[model samples]
Target: MSDRTQEMEEQVAYLHKTVEELSDVIAKQDMELRALTQRVDLLIRREADRQSEAPGAAIFGDERPPHY
Candidate 1:
Protein backbone atom coordinates (compact mmCIF):
# COMPACT_ATOMS: atom_id res chain seq x y z
CA MET A 1 0.00 0.00 0.00
CA SER A 2 1.03 3.56 -0.60
CA ASP A 3 2.43 5.54 2.36
CA ARG A 4 -0.56 7.79 2.29
CA THR A 5 -2.96 4.85 2.41
CA GLN A 6 -1.01 3.22 5.25
CA GLU A 7 -1.00 6.46 7.22
CA MET A 8 -4.75 6.82 6.76
CA GLU A 9 -5.35 3.26 7.88
CA GLU A 10 -3.23 3.79 10.99
CA GLN A 11 -5.11 6.95 11.85
CA VAL A 12 -8.42 5.20 11.42
CA ALA A 13 -7.33 2.37 13.65
CA TYR A 14 -6.12 4.80 16.27
CA LEU A 15 -9.38 6.68 16.15
CA HIS A 16 -11.35 3.44 16.51
CA LYS A 17 -9.38 2.46 19.57
CA THR A 18 -9.81 5.90 21.08
CA VAL A 19 -13.56 5.82 20.44
CA GLU A 20 -13.89 2.41 22.13
CA GLU A 21 -11.96 3.60 25.16
CA LEU A 22 -14.05 6.72 25.42
CA SER A 23 -17.25 4.67 25.08
CA ASP A 24 -16.17 2.43 27.96
CA VAL A 25 -15.36 5.45 30.13
CA ILE A 26 -18.72 6.98 29.32
CA ALA A 27 -20.56 3.78 30.19
CA LYS A 28 -18.78 3.51 33.54
CA GLN A 29 -19.49 7.14 34.29
CA ASP A 30 -23.17 6.64 33.42
CA MET A 31 -23.47 3.75 35.83
CA GLU A 32 -21.72 5.69 38.58
CA LEU A 33 -23.97 8.69 37.96
CA ARG A 34 -27.07 6.52 38.25
CA ALA A 35 -25.87 5.04 41.52
CA LEU A 36 -25.05 8.49 42.86
CA THR A 37 -28.45 9.82 41.80
CA GLN A 38 -30.23 7.02 43.61
CA ARG A 39 -28.14 7.62 46.70
CA VAL A 40 -28.95 11.33 46.63
CA ASP A 41 -32.66 10.62 46.19
CA LEU A 42 -32.63 8.23 49.11
CA LEU A 43 -30.83 10.77 51.25
CA ILE A 44 -33.31 13.49 50.31
CA ARG A 45 -36.25 11.28 51.17
CA ARG A 46 -34.72 10.36 54.50
CA GLU A 47 -34.12 13.99 55.31
CA ALA A 48 -37.69 14.85 54.38
CA ASP A 49 -38.99 12.07 56.59
CA ARG A 50 -36.87 13.25 59.48
CA GLN A 51 -38.06 16.82 59.05
CA SER A 52 -41.67 15.70 58.90
CA GLU A 53 -41.27 13.59 62.01
CA ALA A 54 -40.00 16.58 63.93
CA PRO A 55 -41.61 19.83 62.88
CA GLY A 56 -39.55 21.96 65.23
CA ALA A 57 -36.24 20.29 64.27
CA ALA A 58 -34.54 22.42 61.64
CA ILE A 59 -32.88 20.86 58.61
CA PHE A 60 -29.52 20.68 60.39
CA GLY A 61 -31.01 21.21 63.87
CA ASP A 62 -29.90 24.82 63.89
CA GLU A 63 -32.43 27.22 65.35
CA ARG A 64 -33.26 30.45 63.59
CA PRO A 65 -32.09 33.72 65.05
CA PRO A 66 -34.46 35.57 67.40
CA HIS A 67 -34.82 38.33 64.81
CA TYR A 68 -36.21 35.75 62.41
Candidate 2:
Protein backbone atom coordinates (compact mmCIF):
# COMPACT_ATOMS: atom_id res chain seq x y z
CA MET A 1 0.00 0.00 0.00
CA SER A 2 1.09 3.61 -0.63
CA ASP A 3 2.33 5.74 2.31
CA ARG A 4 -0.58 8.19 1.90
CA THR A 5 -3.13 5.38 2.06
CA GLN A 6 -1.50 4.00 5.23
CA GLU A 7 -1.57 7.42 6.88
CA MET A 8 -5.27 7.80 6.15
CA GLU A 9 -6.04 4.42 7.65
CA GLU A 10 -4.17 5.30 10.83
CA GLN A 11 -6.06 8.57 11.15
CA VAL A 12 -9.36 6.80 10.77
CA ALA A 13 -8.44 4.32 13.44
CA TYR A 14 -7.46 7.12 15.84
CA LEU A 15 -10.73 8.94 15.27
CA HIS A 16 -12.72 5.80 15.93
CA LYS A 17 -10.96 5.24 19.23
CA THR A 18 -11.55 8.83 20.34
CA VAL A 19 -15.24 8.60 19.53
CA GLU A 20 -15.64 5.42 21.55
CA GLU A 21 -13.95 6.95 24.59
CA LEU A 22 -16.18 10.01 24.47
CA SER A 23 -19.29 7.83 24.20
CA ASP A 24 -18.33 5.92 27.35
CA VAL A 25 -17.76 9.14 29.29
CA ILE A 26 -21.17 10.47 28.25
CA ALA A 27 -22.91 7.25 29.36
CA LYS A 28 -21.33 7.43 32.81
CA GLN A 29 -22.37 11.05 33.29
CA ASP A 30 -25.95 10.23 32.23
CA MET A 31 -26.18 7.48 34.85
CA GLU A 32 -24.91 9.79 37.59
CA LEU A 33 -27.42 12.48 36.63
CA ARG A 34 -30.30 10.01 36.80
CA ALA A 35 -29.26 8.84 40.26
CA LEU A 36 -29.02 12.41 41.56
CA THR A 37 -32.47 13.23 40.19
CA GLN A 38 -34.01 10.25 41.96
CA ARG A 39 -32.38 11.26 45.24
CA VAL A 40 -33.74 14.81 44.96
CA ASP A 41 -37.24 13.48 44.27
CA LEU A 42 -37.09 11.26 47.34
CA LEU A 43 -36.02 14.20 49.53
CA ILE A 44 -38.87 16.36 48.25
CA ARG A 45 -41.44 13.66 49.01
CA ARG A 46 -40.06 13.17 52.50
CA GLU A 47 -40.31 16.90 53.30
CA ALA A 48 -43.88 17.02 52.04
CA ASP A 49 -44.81 14.08 54.25
CA ARG A 50 -43.29 15.77 57.30
CA GLN A 51 -45.25 18.96 56.67
CA SER A 52 -48.47 17.04 56.20
CA GLU A 53 -48.03 15.14 59.40
CA ALA A 54 -47.68 18.35 61.45
CA PRO A 55 -50.63 20.58 60.64
CA GLY A 56 -50.00 23.41 63.16
CA ALA A 57 -46.22 23.37 63.34
CA ALA A 58 -44.52 26.77 62.94
CA ILE A 59 -42.63 26.77 59.69
CA PHE A 60 -39.29 28.43 59.18
CA GLY A 61 -39.49 32.26 59.10
CA ASP A 62 -43.11 32.10 60.32
CA GLU A 63 -42.50 32.39 64.06
CA ARG A 64 -44.70 34.67 66.19
CA PRO A 65 -43.33 37.87 67.69
CA PRO A 66 -41.53 37.66 71.02
CA HIS A 67 -44.11 39.93 72.69
CA TYR A 68 -46.93 37.55 71.78
Candidate 3:
Protein backbone atom coordinates (compact mmCIF):
# COMPACT_ATOMS: atom_id res chain seq x y z
CA MET A 1 0.00 0.00 0.00
CA SER A 2 1.06 3.61 -0.57
CA ASP A 3 2.38 5.70 2.35
CA ARG A 4 -0.70 7.92 2.25
CA THR A 5 -3.02 4.90 2.38
CA GLN A 6 -1.12 3.42 5.36
CA GLU A 7 -1.31 6.74 7.25
CA MET A 8 -5.04 7.04 6.60
CA GLU A 9 -5.61 3.49 7.84
CA GLU A 10 -3.75 4.23 11.08
CA GLN A 11 -5.78 7.37 11.64
CA VAL A 12 -9.01 5.48 11.07
CA ALA A 13 -8.03 2.83 13.61
CA TYR A 14 -7.17 5.46 16.22
CA LEU A 15 -10.46 7.26 15.62
CA HIS A 16 -12.42 4.02 16.01
CA LYS A 17 -10.76 3.29 19.34
CA THR A 18 -11.45 6.81 20.57
CA VAL A 19 -15.06 6.58 19.52
CA GLU A 20 -15.57 3.32 21.45
CA GLU A 21 -14.06 4.77 24.63
CA LEU A 22 -16.16 7.89 24.31
CA SER A 23 -19.30 5.79 23.83
CA ASP A 24 -18.65 3.92 27.10
CA VAL A 25 -18.10 7.17 29.00
CA ILE A 26 -21.24 8.69 27.57
CA ALA A 27 -23.32 5.64 28.53
CA LYS A 28 -22.08 5.75 32.12
CA GLN A 29 -22.76 9.46 32.35
CA ASP A 30 -26.28 8.94 30.98
CA MET A 31 -27.05 6.40 33.69
CA GLU A 32 -25.73 8.67 36.43
CA LEU A 33 -27.73 11.59 35.04
CA ARG A 34 -30.92 9.51 35.04
CA ALA A 35 -30.40 8.58 38.69
CA LEU A 36 -29.76 12.20 39.59
CA THR A 37 -32.88 13.28 37.72
CA GLN A 38 -35.00 10.75 39.60
CA ARG A 39 -33.62 11.94 42.92
CA VAL A 40 -34.44 15.51 42.02
CA ASP A 41 -37.97 14.53 41.05
CA LEU A 42 -38.48 12.74 44.34
CA LEU A 43 -37.22 15.73 46.30
CA ILE A 44 -39.54 18.04 44.38
CA ARG A 45 -42.55 15.83 45.09
CA ARG A 46 -41.64 15.60 48.76
CA GLU A 47 -41.31 19.36 49.04
CA ALA A 48 -44.65 19.88 47.30
CA ASP A 49 -46.34 17.48 49.66
CA ARG A 50 -44.81 19.19 52.65
CA GLN A 51 -45.99 22.58 51.42
CA SER A 52 -49.52 21.27 50.82
CA GLU A 53 -49.65 19.70 54.25
CA ALA A 54 -48.49 22.88 55.96
CA PRO A 55 -48.42 26.30 54.34
CA GLY A 56 -46.42 27.98 57.11
CA ALA A 57 -43.81 25.24 57.39
CA ALA A 58 -40.23 26.43 57.71
CA ILE A 59 -38.61 26.34 54.31
CA PHE A 60 -35.07 26.02 55.69
CA GLY A 61 -35.73 24.63 59.14
CA ASP A 62 -36.28 28.19 60.41
CA GLU A 63 -38.46 31.26 59.76
CA ARG A 64 -35.60 33.51 58.61
CA PRO A 65 -35.55 34.31 54.90
CA PRO A 66 -32.57 33.92 52.59
CA HIS A 67 -31.73 37.60 52.93
CA TYR A 68 -31.47 37.30 56.71
Each model's TM-score? 0.82, 0.74, 0.73
Residue lDDT tens for model 2, 1-68? 99999999999999999999999999999999999999999998887778778889755435677888
Ranking by lDDT: 1, 2, 3
Q: Name every residue pair that clashes in candidate 2.
A: none
Candidate RMSDs in order:
3.7, 5.6, 3.4
lDDT of 2: 0.89
Model 1, C-alpha of 3: deviation from truth (Å): 0.6
Query: What is the C-alpha lDDT profile of model 1 across 1-68, one tens digit per residue?
Result: 89999999999999999999999999999999999999999998897788889967667535676787
Off by over 4 Å in 2: 58-68
How many residue pairs clash in all the candidates, one count each?
0, 0, 0
Model 3 residue 62 CA deviation in Å: 19
* Model 3 misplaced regions, further than 4 Å: 55-68
